[model samples]
Target: MKQPLRLHTPRLILRDFQREDSEAVLAYQSKPAYLEHYERPAPTREEARAFVDMLCRWAEEQPRAKYQLAITLDGGQVMGTCGVRKAAPGDTVAEYGCELDPACWKHGYALEASRHLLTWSFETLGVRKLFALTRPQNLSAIRLAEALGFHRVEDGRYELTCP
Candidate 1:
């Protein structure tokens, strides 16, 4: 969908990541234990730049199945990242995920961005099914998935079916 890929919620904007955002991404991804559930975090400027490059490449792909929108406040201060992307090789289904700055957690940004991502995936991208995988210990992700109507398909796996 070559439409500039901007999604707006009541208080957030999901937009493409830019080169200059590497600094913010690095900071957020390195905020101590904010990334405990995920991998080691984007430990360095180089890693952050790599992530931005990945996002740019995905944004440039035709059919644009991957979306790594920077979750930002209404005024454009990025606070997180969330979107759907190809789940795996040979898998037509997409995977939904999000990571919010701990400082901004519990303000419902994850929930808002996730709902918008799911809606855009189904309504615009014609995605029929989506899945979210999180560690069983990641209570927030599990709760968000369930609150957004994603069903527990198995341990640590949630699936959302779109009509």
Candidate 2:
């Protein structure tokens, strides 16, 4: 699906990641707690640069298989990254994920960002279903998914269908 250059909400501006966003991304990613959640080891500084480059490249592609946005405030402070992607070819179910800076946790930003994302995926992308996978112990993610109208589909997996 083609993505707009940016999306706005009452309190957030979702935009493509900028070159300057690397520092903020790196800062949050450096947190040991956050790093543990990723499948791979924590990125080195050089690797982080490459990762950001990949994010920007994906954001620039039209009809992309995946799109990620840098979640920011209206004032332009970077919060984290949130995105949706085709789970598999012609699967009808897209995968969603979000990460918020530790400093910005508990502010409801993840939910707000997710609401916009799900709307865009369902309406703009013509998606009918969305899903998320998280560690079973991640209560906050589970709550956020439930708050956004997802139901437990399986162990550590949740699904949300369009209304």
Candidate 3:
């Protein structure tokens, strides 16, 4: 499988994870506000390194398939991650998720990253549909999903598919 490599948007670059990203990942994940509703908060540096290593492994194994990308601004500031992963056998779809720095919120970064991944999933990976699960209290994410053309499917689930 060819690795899922870097993609560029107008103001951002979505690329594969790098070991160097550990510190930035920690900076956002460590924030109490960021983890308030997340089940897993930021990990220690060692754990973060492991997590990033996992991302690199996934990218290499699946290529244009299941992948986790590091979202960075043009200037190389690591913002967060976005990705698509294959769903269960009976599902015939893919799951998507993202996390971004709070300091970068409300600037359309999430939408840009998501759009890029969704396009890759459909056009590159041939995924038929995409789904996302977010906490009910995370209204911002819910709204962003809606704005990106995902329809609410349940309390904390949303979905989108290629036409």
Per-candidate local distance difference test:
0.84, 0.83, 0.83
Worst 10 residues of 3 by lDDT: 58-67
Judge candidate 2 against the unseen true structure and give its global Cα lDDT, from 0 to 1: 0.83
**Better model by TM-score: candidate 2 vs candidate 3:** 3
lDDT of 3 by residue, 11-121 (tens): 999998888888889888888878876888568999888888888877776223467899999949688999888843334488888889988888999999988888877
Stretches of candidate 1 off by over 4 Å are 1-3, 39-42, 87-92
Best candidate according to TM-score? 1
**Candidate 2, position 35, lDDT:** 67
Instruction: Output the TM-score of candidate 3.
Output: 0.90
By TM-score rank, best first, the candidates go: 1, 3, 2
Model 1 Cα displacement at 126 (Å)? 0.3
Question: What TM-score against the true fold does each predicted structure earn?
Answer: 0.90, 0.88, 0.90
Q: Count the backbone clashes (under 3 Å) in each candidate.
A: 0, 0, 0
In candidate 1, how many clashes are counted?
A: 0
Model 1 lDDT per residue over 32-134, tens place: 7577787664478998899888998788777566888999898466788998888543345888888988889999989999888889888877777888898
Model 2 lDDT per residue over 1-163, tens place: 4544688889999888877788888888888777666667767888778878898877766546676888999847788989888854345678888998878889999999989988988887777888899888888889999999999989999999999
Candidate 3: residue 89 lDDT (0-100): 32
